[model samples]
Target: MKQSLTRRAMLGALGTAVAATAGCQSPGTGSDSGSDTGEQPESADAVAQSDSVYTNVYQEVADAVVSIRVYAEDSRGGQGSGFLIDDEHIVTNEHVVAGGDEYYVRFADTGWRTASVVGADVYSDLAVLRIGATPDVTPLSFVETEPTVGTEVVAIGNPFGLSGSVSAGIVSGVDRTLQSANNFSIADAVQTDAPVNPGNSGGPLVTLEGDVVGVINSGGGDNVAFAISAPLTQRVVPSLIQTGDYDHPYMGVGLRSVSPRVAEANNLDPGSGVYITRVVSDGPAAGVLQGSDGETTISGTAIPTGGDVVRQMDDTPTPTRQALGSFLALETSPGETVDVLVERDGAQETVELTLGTRPEP
Candidate 1:
């Protein structure tokens, strides 16, 4: 089962979150990057500004931004936020309502209404909700472009129980991988500094123009915060809302970036590709592929290893394991077979390995 995010843990595949309903400060104060107390630069000219970017953004998105409340057994319910993608559908992190509990949605003006999960994908950390009643709500349009570095964005949610709180910041980085509470890596994420907190999970990370670009997920380490990208969400959202799983190719070898020392000891080019750090015993790569074995020393550094150095995935060259993982997701499927090129013993060879099911972790 997915652990609740409130417990400072999460279930595998972006499981549930426990939102806060009370005990929070004004939005920007909780996170240092979002300093609410700072005075705004005011212009003396009459009627400073109107019809600006963020104008009506909150009002437009508020009807769509819902307060999510979930109830589990043992009287341990959780809280989080979600946004409506359509009048009837909503998007949120899978962790917002994991464990198949009863869920409800509360609007800015309305009371709680029942909600049901349409579909959820753990690999992508996305879920869709069907609002029970046909309440009038405005859905935020999604931004088309992937957010660029230094792009201004806003974070909106009920942080630590304060509803209707919003903060602003810029895109810090992209394609970041963070370790989830369950010790699994949430890959290809968007990093921001917009003050995401416990209650902010599953809320919208919108543009200055009010278009949603990502879903706020987590924060830590000085001013670091992160979200799952909207483009990724767009690619996987439909399938997740319709099916509980997102299908992708499964390569059975554990891999890592080939370090300089290991590559030299193995008589291979380190920067040229990723190294298959481990192969599951009797797994797909065991009989068809060759890899490192026994102890080797280079530059007086000893390394115990076994597995092949991957030079390419199909037609694309992969220089790191993370790149290989992203590549695999793009061009493979479960139960498919593909040619893998590997370098072993100062020679390059190719072998076809049938993909296998990703074992439960």
Candidate 2:
């Protein structure tokens, strides 16, 4: 079941707290007590100018952001946040609506409305919902370019059921790999210092200019939080809207970055490329690529050897697993043939492998 405190009741409680604090003040310290400090208050114009960016962004975006409450079959439910992408479509985290039997959404200017899940992708943690009617609010758009590190951004969501709340931070890192289900990783994620808490997932992490940079995924007590990158969102959301699910490109091979130990045992340059640990039988890369066939003890540590080191994929240098994963996720699709450059037997060769759709988790 869903629950919320009315805005009027919340304001009334705040007013009582303020009155109590005022009563506790000393006699001569009141605003009209004639006891004045040297500094004077700034003018309204000055304050307005200083806060214009954040205030304007909130006004532009908050109306489209909605608080979502989900009820499941067993009478258990929780809340999260989402934002409008179009007239009747809302984008949110897949985990937010997972296992829910009924869904309700409340916009800033509208009462709760029934919603239904259009599609959801667990690998990307993105979901789409459709409502019967939508308020007249401009749908949010993703930033055309990837936001650089330190670019100021805002997160608008209902944190801990606090509807229409906003927080500010900067993009701290990008191209991050977030762990997902079944040993898979969500690549090219954005990291931020924004104060995201429970109930914030599925909301838009937007630039100060009101352009979305990422979708809020998870946060912790530490000053670190993460979002699904805009590029990936741009790729996943449309398909989710058209179809009930999104298919992720899969290679079906276990990979590890070639560290110095791995490189030495495999007789390759240190930190050169990604090493193939195990290739799935009868999978996409089964006949095209070769996995490690032997193991060697290097300084008492067993290291897999005799594997094909993937140097590049479709002209993109895969120096690490993150790079390879990103390339596969953003650039390739299922059934697409990709040219893989690999180092085998101290020589370089190109192999073509057709990608496959990922299996259900």
Candidate 3:
């Protein structure tokens, strides 16, 4: 799907051309644009089964979807999609309410109602908001486990203010790491080919049975879209609702994945690992994890050397950037210390440091 927020503005600019041709009534002669006559419908039995499943599912969950419009400084600012998790609580993307001082939530059952931001976690790109009052709205349930790859999934949201739009696709992949607004990567993302446009962010990516498996977040190349996994959402949303923030473990060190080429150039083992390039002063890794002490050129390519190369963290061996971030985000909480094994000067050494909280950006 296209990014609907920007698409909405662009569609407005083409109104004149659309209007000029609005009166022209050439049924078959105008264009063969939307009609693909070469394709044929499936058998009656197949079509009936498919229609029954999706129609029944939509009827059960359609009431939970709503349209969210953000207002900045008493003026219409931006718009996106969101869904009710409870009578008073709604979940959406953090960027939706990042700048808005006021919010207007519109639904089919209940009209517009004022809302206030409860909490927003930038690291996860998820936010919670409390409306003025509770209504008789049905909340969607996130599944306990993620759906398998290639399983069919459905997307529901408001695209360009068209409330309650539906799209269907399959789970393209699982356990993806997507970059957040703050430059920190959010781990365990679910990737799908569903047409999730701009307004679809914060909506539900539900199974055929109407169970929420993910939250539609952002659109990427082709029809590829990324969503926050239901497992991650379940883990983070409760803390956000209760405490207004979620704590993530911080190492305060810049790490890069060591490839085989770089490892060979440094005259180290062929197995790849994580290299510490820089350590923030006064931060958790400061004085504990050494930064690059020198630079060397290997085959016309300059590379940093003489830094701590992480071999393992606890039970993990030769972790990449994704592996390390996932362990910190999912396995360990703030203030928890993990045993770190590093290679310094061709010797194995152990370092123990208490994990700290990520400071505000």
Candidate 4:
């Protein structure tokens, strides 16, 4: 399991480290000890070495990160962060530009420039912005490989209107599911301990090598924050740019992960797969997939029974709701036909279903 630090504890530890470091230096040993000059007490070399990796990443990527200010039709406005993905385009969260009549972005090297929403996808919480011209900075690229747990990462964004802010921590979890609008969940998310707050959304969560691994999504102020994974972003952003929207494959069915009680009620292996609670009438899985036909009580808890327990989709094991959502989001398209393997009546069977485009939220 990953370790966590409360805000008070983290600050306390920082204070202790500072105090211990100060105590380590001899009182009259440094060259500027007796001087009245207000320069830094430590040599430039020492300061550079202390935070070389973070410093280098910040210098390399900060120029391309932008602060976004959004103005709504009714004089309401908010701010968030984003980063350039190309010479003329920027990537941000869909929620950031929602209900905005005007969008403006400011780069570290340039003044605020007018921008337009080229596309936005609420399902994935990703949006693309087009600017007439951008500062002479290289666009950030997503990491080619998935970052493993404990990989060092940084969140670069404007938090609470503070521009050019950077926070550092390790990737604490992967393949996480985050709640989104429309009662849906954003799947395959990356969780980090990097301190992100309001206004950090839409910014790049990059690795030490300056490659973006995720897009900063939300933070709970409890040493926990989440980002849309780079793999999902890569899938959604291109379609948004090309067509002004992205179509998500939809399965119109309510699902629940198989828990101990649910497993017992449904006669399933404990904690094995996802259960289909209700399949929408006339929906993609209406005729092909089976939903729960009865309910039972286990330990005074009502559990849906007689439902299809989905074990796999397209040969990919969907052991949880997160795995199922990720498979639909990343591996299939709106019109693709996928093989769904489910255990029904204590027997396993495979069924093919053509996916459908998700309805507007």
Best by TM-score: 4
lDDT of each: 0.69, 0.85, 0.76, 0.85
Task: Give a tens-digit lDDT track for model 1, residues 204-254.
Answer: 988756788888888744677998877677766777767755664556566
Task: Please give the lDDT score for candidate 3.
Answer: 0.76
What's the true lDDT of residue 126 in model 2?
94
How are the candidates ranked when ordered by TM-score, highest leading?
A: 4, 2, 3, 1
What clash pairs does model 2 have?
none
Q: Is candidate 1 or candidate 3 better by TM-score?
A: 3
Clashing pairs in model 1? 2-11, 3-11, 15-95, 16-95, 17-95, 19-79, 291-307, 291-308, 292-307
How does model 2 score by TM-score? 0.87
Model 3 residue 152 distance off true place after TM-score fit, in angstroms:
2.4
The superposed Cα distance between candidate 1 and the true structure at residue 258, in angstroms, equals: 2.2
Separate clash counts for every candidate: 9, 0, 0, 0
What is candidate 3's lDDT per residue for 274-321, written digit by digit as tens? 888888898998978998878888778888888888888888775677
The estimated TM-scores of all candidates read 0.77, 0.87, 0.81, 0.88
Angstrom error of the Cα, residue 40, model 2: value is: 9.6
lDDT of 4 at 34: 31
lDDT for predicted candidate 2 compared with the true structure: 0.85
